[model samples]
Target chain A: MKIALAQISPILQDVRKNINRHLKLAEKAKKERADLIVFPELSLTGYTLQDLVPEAAINPNKDDSFDAFRLISKEISIVLGFVEEKGKGSFYNSAAFISGGEVLHIHRKVFLPTYGMFDEAKFFSQGKDISAFQTPFGKTGLLICYDFLNYGANYVLFSQGADIIIALSAAPGRGINENDAFASSHMWELMGETVSRFSTAFVIYCNRVGFEDGKSFAGGSFIYSPEGTAICRASYIDEDFLIEELDLSLLRKARQKLMYKRDNKPEVILKNLYRAVFKNED
Target chain B: MKINTVFVERILTKFIKDELGKFHFKKAVLGLSGGLDSSVTAFLCAKAIGAENVLAIIMPYGESIKKDISDAKKVVKQLGINSKTIHINPMVDAYYSKYPIQNRVIKGNKMARERMSILYDFSSREKAMVIGTSNKTELLLGYGTIHGDMASGINPIGDLYKTQVRQLGKHLGIPEEILKKSPSAGFWPGQTDEKEIGIDYENIDNILYQIVDLRKQKKEVAAMGFSQKTIDRLVEMIKNSEFKRKLPLIPKISERTVGHDFLLPYDWGK
Candidate 1:
């Protein structure tokens, strides 16, 4: 499948401007004949949503914000992140899969990081489940920034029979590792390689680029093959679209070589988790 | 200034250690001015990287106070870090002797730049990143010489205000004498920062916190008990020194301009 990674810089709390940016980028991606286009976490709304969460919140079922995306989905499948307003005073950090001008599935972020500069838990409710849904491409699982950081989250998705996992991240670019200016970006790349290698599934990571609240986001979006090889990488700290050809056949070949999914014993992990939560009781 | 100094110390130390580690740097270098800012930075760097890895250079000029240099030596001895003393008198004398300038302020600026030149030279020689000592107030007020004491590969104390710096000094166990002494660049004898700026750090920090951190307007800041004249002067200083805070301007002749369109952040990791 031909995939497109749109590394965009969303204007903070400005939905209309962001919508226009998505449309322009989607048009650019379409010209390259991309079958799928993916954007970063909080691509619709910039990531620094504190009190502005309510103001910038979008109800996908009712809001017109996804209309442009829906129209774009008619030509190419697109995945993006936004603030999902579930009900009155209830919100979630979510990503939706849109294909053929319809909402395929909505994956709310499970791990809301509250450490350091991140304060997602203070604002959004945590998702309770990790599940892969049917998509035009394959059984695709979606994850937000912190969710992708957790090894267990990816394992759960793979165990649920996901062939493709897409990570939407709003990660800030940080640290200069001598050669590379963005050290955290390199860290994420290493994580991507590890996850893809272990699961033997196609992993697509899309991160944003732009400065928000003096913190810069790393836009080094990447795609990894099932063999743990980085197939393509987008630009860092810039709004650019990277179009690459994805070979899904590599998944079957890799899994056949190392069947980790088949050998994974969930019952053992489940017992350990139970013991951890209820030590004396168990 | 009123921030929790212990917490600042922990976080800033972690930040310094993490940034240096990321860059594959095991050492750091900075000019030890024996003032509150440099002292606080030195303490933090020592904690973060290591006392053995931190290099404190004491660059005294012709008119530098003896007490200040001794204070710097005390810090070096206290921390047990690598220390070097390079008298900047000869270098400053060389340039001005060929083309003499009249203004003392201009001469002071040159002295400050000479100090930076020496620091950078030592940094390259030692493979240590130059750590900046200018605090947020000094930075915002354009109080320090541009590309002089302000230049650093990375600054651990630039975010701190002068008042916060003193508090940090206490937390890091800096000498009481250094902390209590009047803040000076030591460009000339009896030179003090407040005397040159004509405003105290307490009021300067209060107004700066409001303007930069709180995002208050000049009118709003003036309403908060500061005189309009002080507000205007501080604002003007910030405006005038804006160029110092940024990279040298690159002309946009091509579609992909160096500074404008093509800005490389050195973030390309292997």
Candidate 2:
């Protein structure tokens, strides 16, 4: 099936404008005959809302903004980002997997960056559970921007029988100059390699672009093939899309490659250790 | 404009050097503009590393004031820095002729990026890291360009407000010409930063330090007797430029990231 990666330019704090941009891009993807189109993290509310998040957080069940996405999901599945409020003051920066005019799954961001240019933990609670949902396209796993850093997170989804890994990231970073002295792309390189190696499924990375507050986003959104090759790359500093077709046949082959070690080793011993350490007499 | 000298020597300067040293970098490069921000950065770099290791480049275009050029020279001389004069008029004009940019914002941004390109190239050639001159006020307001004046390997003055940059300027014995000159990005022929932004450095710095540095909300800023428009505009600027302060997008394949994927310092040892 053809999937469209919506690498969008989100206006800071302007949820309405950003949602409109998302709708426009979804329409554009549908016109290109895409079965599913996914947007960057927090595509509706925009990243870097800071304290304004409390005012902009949406309760998805009551959100009219999501209706625009839900309506389009009838013809083409769409994934988009927005904030979800929970338990009074706590919130989650989340993505929804929508298809056939209904919300299928919502994945809250698991990792919240708290240093350098980020303080997500100051605003958002860490997501507890990973999601694997069945769709017409394939068995897809959901992860917000930082959730990809946990290799075990991908391992769990893959082991649980996921055929596609859709990662929505508001990945923050700087651009590289060919002549610049410093090699600062270390973290980004590592993250990219990790995604391809573990999941061995179609990995879709959707990133936001443009300047917000003092932080400028380096928009290098791309798709990694099951073999870890970057099949399509979005343009830097602009809104773009990389629509491609995926073959589930390759995913099955990848799973078969890792099947041998799936049952062998440490989890058996760990389960017994857990039972021994915390035996309940009551 | 009083500052704790102990903080400068013990914390800020040492932190600046330590950050550079962590990357195995030994020297710092500054595009000494004879303006308050650049002068302050030059001063801090000298103190952080040493006068000998601090390389200052006096970049002057054709339309630049002779006094500013002399003032930049004076800063380097006083700081006893390793200095170079690279006249950029030929390069800038040559590129502008070929590109012929009509939009002022785009042109200014390109010029800033071009300046950064030169600085980065020189930084590589000199084996030094480019030190940033943007202050907290500029950064918060989106007052600088990305990959141009906004880009740096390390920024010694990014946290300081523009007003505080001046205070640090005085502590570093920056010449009165640079210390007292009106703030400008020096992008165009007659562009003053205040004239463009419609706010003075003093007010911008005060509001920024309160709203951003002190974590005071917009209402709190208004209650401090500032105009509501000023507070709103400053808050908007801060919110708008938030993306400029982060890392490039990395797809979350792992459970954590340096960004939305994980949270940790680059220097955090494994």
Identify the runs in model 2 with alpha carbons over 4 angstroms from their true place: A87-89, A174-186, A256-282, B1-270
DockQ for each candidate? 0.03, 0.03
Model 2 agreement with the true structure over B190-244: per-residue lDDT tens digits: 6788897687888877888777656798898889888999788778877888888
Highest-lDDT candidate: 1
Kept native contacts, as fractions per model, are 0.00, 0.00
| Interface CA RMSD, all predictions | 14.8, 15.9
* lDDT of candidate 1 over A72-126, digit per residue (tens): 8999998988899998878998999999998989999999999877778888999
Candidate 1 on B175-204: residue-level lDDT in tens?
Answer: 999999887767678888889777888888
DockQ of 1: 0.03
Model 1 regions more than 4 Å off: A280-282, B1-270
lDDT string, candidate 2, A1-282, tens digits? 888988775765677777787788888889999999988888887787766677778877876877877888999999888888876777899889999988999988887888866789887878888878898878889887778777767776766666678888787554222322112233544565566656576777777764454344556677776656667777654567788887757766766775522553447655765787799522
**TM-score of each predicted structure versus truth:** 0.56, 0.53
